[model samples]
Target: MNGSKISFLAFGELVVRQLTDFSNNAFAALILLIQDARTPMAVSSGGDDIMQSHES
Candidate 1:
């Protein structure tokens, strides 16, 4: 019982960290998209990076 509880807590913490990172990346990408709407090149690069991160 004690081992399972510890493992569950560890798993939950890992999930929360991953979610936080993903949300932060998404927010940054959104801001970049808005700020660079006029510049297709910049937007494309940031968007590509976001896609790569998503795959990872």
Candidate 2:
């Protein structure tokens, strides 16, 4: 690998609305709201579950 020929990418979508609305929501407030929401909540660790990970 040649250092001079190397470049890198950080590709992803920017959530513009979320970014702008961020100022109105404090960290604690966001946490409390997420906790209170009536949806099934689970934290993802690294890759998705086993089936999806292997399929990809």
Candidate 3:
């Protein structure tokens, strides 16, 4: 593969890894809050659960 092609693939891989890390961290935090008897709150950009909160 060309150098440019390899660079693009590496960039894409980094993006995917970052996203996976973020998701794992978010879920871990939620679990910790639940175990501590705190509210499992999450602030997402957009999702069905975000719109269907009891506060609304």
Candidate 4:
């Protein structure tokens, strides 16, 4: 019984650790996605300006 309890606790700890890591990675990816989204908008606007200048 004691051995089974110890194993169960270890499994729970591993699950918690994995969940923490997953959440951290997910947060980092979200931040990166937001930055990427902002960058494309800025770049597109800048590109349009360049195109207009060339046309004129």
Candidate 5:
């Protein structure tokens, strides 16, 4: 029970972060943002990187 609660909290934080990060992004650009939220963040990277890579 405690583990699930902790997981829920972490998920909520990620959601808030996502919302904030995508606030200025366009609706079209938001599609990928929403899709990425469905995946486990820790596993999103190969476990070596936590931040996304940008070319610009």
Candidate 6:
């Protein structure tokens, strides 16, 4: 391929790599968000369970 075509291909490759990295980071962030949400709920429910057992 000529110089311009090679450069265009390289640019396209860079864009694809960047998009892949972004998607991976976004997925990781989503997982962290889900874990964070679940942690609070789990802790609250556990605490409630303990409190109920103590009351009884």
| Over 4 Å off, model 6 | 41-56
Identify the runs in model 1 with alpha carbons over 4 angstroms from their true place. Answer: 38-56
Task: By lDDT, rank the candidates, best first.
Answer: 4, 1, 6, 3, 5, 2
**TM-score result, candidate 4:** 0.69
Tell me how candidate 1 scores on lDDT.
0.88
Q: Write one digit per residue (lDDT tens) for candidate 3, span 1-56.
A: 69999999999999999999999999999887776554333433444477667559
Model 1, span 1-56: residue lDDT tens: 99999999999999999999999999999988888886654667778788789899
RMSD score of candidate 3 (Å): 10.0
Question: For model 2, where is the 10-residue window of minimal lDDT?
Answer: 4-13
Superposition error at 6 for model 4 (Å): 0.6
Model 3 weakest 10-residue run by lDDT: 39-48
Instruction: List, residue by residue over 1-56, the lDDT tens digit for candidate 5.
Output: 99999999999999998997778576757777776666646445653253444322
Which candidate do you rate higher for lDDT, 1 or 5?
1
State the number of backbone clashes in model 4.
0
Q: Show the colliding residue pairs in model 5.
A: none
Off by over 4 Å in 2: 1-25, 38-56
Q: lDDT: which is higher, 2 or 4?
A: 4
- Per-model TM-score, in order, reads 0.66, 0.23, 0.59, 0.69, 0.42, 0.69
Clashes of each: 0, 0, 0, 0, 0, 0
Most accurate candidate by lDDT: 4
lDDT at 8, model 5:
100
Q: Against the unseen true structure, what C-alpha lDDT does each candidate score? A: 0.88, 0.52, 0.77, 0.88, 0.71, 0.87
Candidates arranged by TM-score, highest first: 6, 4, 1, 3, 5, 2
Worst 10 residues of 6 by lDDT: 39-48
Residue 23 error for model 1, in Å? 0.2
Residue lDDT tens for model 6, 1-56:
59999999999999999999999999999998888787764656787788789899
Clashing pairs in 1: none
